[model samples]
Target: MNDAHHRDADAPLRMTDAQHREMRNAQHRETQRAVSGFRGDIEGLRGLAVLLVLVFHAGVPAVSGGFVGVDVFFVISGFLITGLIVREVRTTGRLSLARFYARRARRLLPAAAVVLAAVAALTVAALPPIRWSGVAGDLAASALYAVNWRLADQAVDYMASEQASSPVQHFWSLAVEEQFYLVWPLVLLALVWWHRRTGWSLDRTLLAGLAIVALPSLVWSVSLTQVEPGRAYFVSTTRAWELAIGAALAIGAVRLSRLPRAAMVWAGWLGVFAIVVAALAYGSSTLFPGYAALLPTVGAALVIMAGLAGRGRNAAGTGGAAGYGRGVGRFLSVAPMRAVGALSYSLYLWHWPLLVAAEAAWGALSVVEGILVVSLSFVPAWLTYRLVESPVRRSGRLVAVPRRALLMGAACTAAGVAGAVVVHAAVPPPPQVTASAGSRPATQALAETSKRPTAKPPPQDEPTSITLDPLKAREDKGPIYRPQCHQDQPSAELQFCAYGDLGSDKVMVLAGDSHAAQWQPALAAIATRHGWRLETYTKSACGFFDVEVGVGEPAVPYPACTAWNAKLLQRLTGPDRPDLVVTSSDTNYQVVRGGSILDPQASRPAYVSGLRRSWQAVRAAGVPLVVIRNTPRVNIDVPDCLSAHPRDLAACAVPRERAMAMSTDDQIRAAEGLAGVDLVDLTDDVCPAPRCAPVIGTMIVWRDAHHITATYARSLAPRLDRAMAQAIGGRTSSTAE
Candidate 1:
């Protein structure tokens, strides 16, 4: 029965049952060692990270720096995963890719799948239908470990920026880690193969390979953070260096473990200080994962390195596998830290959804309420850790059999996808309401409604909540959007999209930012009805001002807008000039001068000067100009807020004074002395005297916070047409025909 003896029949081969049992026992011990040589210190680090993130989410101002805990986590993950791979390669002389991946599957996928499913189901029930589709897509991406890239794509997307946060947004980090897990092993396998063929030591080879990968990634991180900080925050390339720092430590683990006790103690304490300080000093404006990230990542690296110093039998003259009882290692090995660390994964998974759900249900939370929600997160975290994470992770049968583990992982993935599909299917679409037969003419309706005694419109006059039709409300964009006529800030070329009678000589040009674009529906209606040509030239985030302004995150100078405006000015004054030119802008951006940002107070005069210059040029060309005041800004998303407060739709209205305060009053002053420019104020039409209501005469007034919905815009056609005819001083020769 002894295959070794049978193969070499010439040798007298005899083995006792005791020898066989001993050999089998040794293998079993090695497997157990590989799977369960628990690192209490590492668990404590995990505990620290989760605690930081949880407190930060709890809205504790002191822990503003707590977001850096994610960077710390990247370091810890890299160190531990690389250490395991190095150990296996050193002992077995080759890597077991199947077993390594199977272990990762059991440890990460099961609990993650549970959270994804729960998020999808809860999102459908609790959140607005507007967010459901996004949440569903995020769920599928999270399940497949690709949400980070998806989020990165969305981050720079101007339209999606206004969307509310997804419940599973935290999974972006997990996706990055999962991506590393998939790629790192193959890299390690190649290193091990090269070690077998060539004479290079495995540790040196790994260190060199990690350096090769980490250095360029670090360079890319710094470069991208400078230009596109928003997208850089979520992308994996920006975070790879953080992981590589830990991998490098794992490669030199034995060498690092031999440092002096005193040195380790200082390093550990200093690292903890660095981490806390970085968290405190940093804020939303801090360009992350760039040089700024070095503070936390290096701090985490020090803490991890210091924790290993003079420990684990790797120290010179140390005997056995006993670890040293000195430095931060002793501090981190404490039971409380280990206990929390044990549940860290589940805690992290549960906390974000709870916070998002709390915010969705009850606007912003008080400090005390936030603390309570974070504390309540512990309950589910404990349950998941004990019932799901611990049981499956500890089962030897699961770890010992790669096939079963993979199948289990596959099943969990399938369940997550199925849950998302079911949630999407279960949620019904918004009801479509036809135009009411009793709908009044927009101008006459406003005139009659203004005569009513009370500021609040009566229930009979109130519009049904078109906000409930969330999808329709979001799609209620102007005609310029569908034709891609709205130019973004990056483009200088003029995009001319005409609406209504293009053959008519009575031409009306609409130009400005998205605020101006919102009027296209009404402009088109008037142009078509009166046989006038309506031309549109609008851009997102860019206004009509000729002055330089800082916009977007980090307040970058908008040179494109300046360039586009100059070209527009020239075209408007040329022989091809329209009979009438209309313009409006958000006017929210700060003016940029000599690379310095000027506040609104200082910038208003500059903005006025810019407006005065542009208007003068247009008037010189014999073209009359109409300047419509920017629309009132209701700081909250009207649709989402109305959806939440369905019964009392009036709850979504803002006081007229407060709503009107958002527009720059300086714009009115800028137009006062200008010749041949007529000013039309329709804000009272949209948001009457005392309050700016979300719904005005059966049409939603605003989409998101600032721009008026197309429905509302279209309803204003009759009033706008009258105003346009006056501004142009009667119809032109083309409209006379």
Candidate 2:
């Protein structure tokens, strides 16, 4: 069979079969009318993208956003893969399931299996036994093409993971591409199938239907980029529109090829310039796949189109369009680039591990060294390409010995999973990976506490705030570690609210979860001074309903936050008639398990219901509800803070640039609803000047990784005083008790 016997005859990621036929029909049309040789140029572009990805992971400063290379890969994949489908469908009348997957298995599985096997063997030897398990588990996920989700879970979490490390991290893109191949061709093929059955132009039909998908996906990509950038990056659903850009091009290349020669050349020129500029100018800060992404993807599309146009230029009195593929096209087609592109799969496989090993050996790779490491991976890639790639691809041996290779791939994947399992099993199930770069007290402290629960000291040690007897803390009343926990309530005998107690005004009830309870001391003092009664109602991880995720979590036994909030809600709405309801929870921890995220429709409605109930309860009680926004979480554990920096002013601070960025949009949205609610945006105070200093003024803001400290709560007395005054319909006073 010709190497170009054409694989990926159908798309892989979409959910239907008819769609596969449409892709084949359209691709057949391209073949019949001369689709040109831009396909090779697209492959070249893929090489450049994979190179960017390889270098970025290799730690090249120049390619900080080199991860965007994956986005580029996606776009290129969409275009070229779609073109193949179109050609197949137009020629064969039907798409072949066996051939499509067989080719993919041959192209992708061999190198991936070899890499996994090598990594597994190397990791078992090099890594401490403690870490081998996790590395193994991630390997399994990678093998199954599900590492993206696995990595995503760890990344988007509100816990202590900054994503600076994680060896299997590079597999995310491969999984994403595989995922794309799974369904996209089906959509194209289905259109063809539908057309064969309905007699419509595959071009107009696919182009129209794909547009419908593209538009909403465009919205979702931007929305997710705003709400969850990391999730947006790894999730195939969010990334499809990017690839669809390429798919649209493959379907419409005939029209582009027919355009005036000069027009095609200019389009091609504009496209090439965009790709180059994007590569050179963009970096990490850009809100990607947002508007910033259009630059590279669309540019690649135009270049591909132009290259296609160029090939067909002189063919039919079309000089430029039919002349030759050049510029980005020609450059990509050069011997060096073509070889790189051909070996790209192997190169991508080898590069990340090599770089990771190099980093482990040398701590960090300098720009020059990073480049060298990436360059070095090619040596192995070349060997693998000739040995692993060429052999499996050329000889029918791979197919003949499919079981052996399949077993090999499975065994490697299983070993990786087993390693991860062992590592994870040794630790708690929801494994937490921490990167303590420096030997600060915080890191050491975290290392101490991260061990299986042995002895936990009292709640945060400070001037005075909350305290909980670990045994009694789990009482029917719920977690009692409030700010004024150790202190008496507001009263003349108590000399008003003490240090932690701010005050309780108009019988203000602070009701919610741990976040809601953190306000007790501040509100206590303020209420005491203002002659208002302050009551606090809280649950550890529970919210107002049984749905909200708590501070300490997995939500298995159900977070105490929801239970406590529910009780408080019941109590406040009934006899208590508390004049105010102030509550908050970590809006980020939406409990999920086993690679599945809770849908917004699932628990979100409950959250909204709770909010509405709270509002209604306050309305009935004739009280105001102060709904504080969930604080942006810090990744460090509190004990780590005390142990690491002890008292260093700038020690564990979240960089000011990052601090000012603001919390999750979901938190904002959750608070935005409600009839008589007052929002207290403390995002500023939480991350103050010079940067979100580890210690704000004199108070450490966090208790553990995500909770607030009583000291920091006290420091925000002034801000809380103001927020409360507005929270309730009354005059407020501020004084540091």
Candidate 3:
């Protein structure tokens, strides 16, 4: 009936029945070993991948590009999983989707659930109340294997970008793998079904399918990485090609198995070299999962292929390179490597949350401290591996029944989701603040002509009760925070919003970057009281200067910002120009010139020239310009500090000299001799000489490190109105009753 019986049917007639039965059993065992035997070399490769990632995350200076290790892991997973599927389909002529999923569930879900539950508890203890709801949401998404999409959406969100990293953010990689597992099998099954119906070669059909799915993803990855690198990093579509390379290797493994031992050994070491080189050469500035990802992914494929070739030689009794313990494989199959590989999955899960918790407790950890925190995670990792992962994966009952394993996986997921829901429910709502009408103290309202003011006596101790809830501070961004009012990257088209006294004949325009946008509440209130129509034109990280600006870490040329500035200047100088154009921008933008980004000190002169050029354009058009000096930055997240230290508010205050130094006031220098451009200095009103209080007159001054809260900005309306009136030659308009 089978190969073993068929081969011995005629030749073994002389042998006894018992001896014939024993020979068949021995051959069957050998066949099973060929299909599913363990590879110690692969285990060692896993150890190497995890070690690279951990060391990089722990701030090891040598492995700047160590993040490439994730690409290696992707390749390894694709090869092993694809090989298993191919062997099953080749042996049985049909794939059992249920059994495949059951095996995956038994191997992954138990460990993941334990880590999620532990992170949820850690969130309650270490993270501030402001972060609890978000972490709970992240936990639920991780359980559903959809956190990657959630993070992808957050990548483009302006406000979300500033929030603290979630402890469970590492789950994004696991989500991508699980999503692949869900779809890859169905695709293979469809190809198998077609093969059965048409008598087509299954291998060729599978290769064609893989090519169709993977090539476009590779092209898209390259294109998207250039335009939207943040979103590109987290999305599944951009990363699929890396896994496909490994799957392609699996499909060709049989043909490649006969390669010479010397060739295999060379390839094995070369692959290791490539992986190590990428780890050392790459850094946070590297654009990832694009063409750059090929180095590590192909390197991993080579290592796996070489290991397979060695095993093939051993099975054939050629004795040249009998096993993985040859060349690089020997190094990989050593005991230390195998042990780390065995615990790699649990270690990966446990390390990230501990690192995040440590950073949250103490501002930022040194390299040694980070390494110590990661090292401490081994205890929980080992416990989870021993108590949960091993027992469930080896459970005889679950293995005997696929349905029971699937049920257990479902139960584990539900428990994780349920725990997240409880944490979400337990988080208290943000406290409410009651607003009251009040007048500003005379000394606090510094005018445009005022001299440099002396340090004021320390304000009475921080109010017992804050007027705005610290939890609600982040959402206190002004009316112009919407997409229609403030444009993001990738769009060069001009977009503006009109508010306050829309029917008034007098016109005023507010224009610049987010620092300019933050003043909208006060300016809008002033416009409403004085009966002037106000139009706002602002873009995130894009200033209203005639300078080539570079943005983001390891800054790249911002062409969109250039285009937006051109369009905005054209509108301001056109026939429908407003009577007054008020502008402000963050002073920290790097200048791009001759294809290079200049350092901060080098960028100052370019900024001054650019500001003068913009101001000259408005003046030539017969429109007056008002430049609000950029506000002082706290250089620390005010809301997070407030939430962490509510009672001892002094701990959140930034020193006066340090805070004021953040405002370089290049605008002041540009406007020195420029006619009809009024410069309004509001630094004294925001920060007195001695120190800048986090809470001023019961109002939270800053919503984040830089942007002022809309509530505080609104309270400054009366002072801003007085300053603007004096700057614009005291135009007459009735104030609102």
Q: What are the lDDT figures for the candidates, one per model?
A: 0.78, 0.60, 0.81
- Give lDDT tens digits, candidate 1, residues 1-737: 58976767744333556577568646533442433245666777888888998988888888877889999999999999998887777667678888898899999989998888889867876786667777888888888889999998887776677778889999999999999999999998887777767878767788878888999999999988765677888999999999999999888876676678688888977887888899888876577778989998998898887766755443222211134355565676677888888889999999999888888988888878888998999998999988999899888899889989989999988887877787667666664434456755343344454534333333222344342564667678976886569886568788879989989988889988888899999889888988889999888777777788875565556777888888888778887888789888887878888977687789888888887788888888888888888888888887777666554556777766788898867678878888888887787777774666776656667788888899878877777777767766765322321
Worst 10 residues of 3 by lDDT: 441-450
Top model by lDDT, which number? 3
Error of 3 at 489 (Å): 2.6
- Write candidate 3's Cα lDDT for 397-446 as tens digits: 99999999999999989988987997798776654433233633232342
- Pairs that collide in candidate 3 are 65-282
Q: RMSD in Å for candidate 2, one decimal?
A: 14.6
Order of all candidates by lDDT, from best down to worst? 3, 1, 2
Q: Candidate 1: which pairs clash?
A: 65-279
C-alpha TM-score for every candidate: 0.86, 0.58, 0.89
Candidate 1 lands at a TM-score of: 0.86
Per-residue alpha-carbon lDDT of model 2 for 1-737, expressed as tens digits?
A: 54434333333434346677677555546443566443556566767777777767666666566666677777777877777777777667678755666666677777787787777665554443333455766787887899888876764453324323456668888898888787776776777777867778878888987897788888888876654565666676677788899888878777666666567667767886776677667765455666778888888778777666634333422322113444556566656666667888888888877776666546447878888888898898899889877787666654666555555445645655554555445432221223244434332243234323312121122212222211111121212453433221111011112222335335666655456666666666666667777665554444444344422121222323443445555666677566556677655445433433454346455555555655666666665677777776656443333332232424555544453333444445655655577777776566534334444323446665556765556556667887767665555754443
**Prediction 2 TM-score vs. true:** 0.58
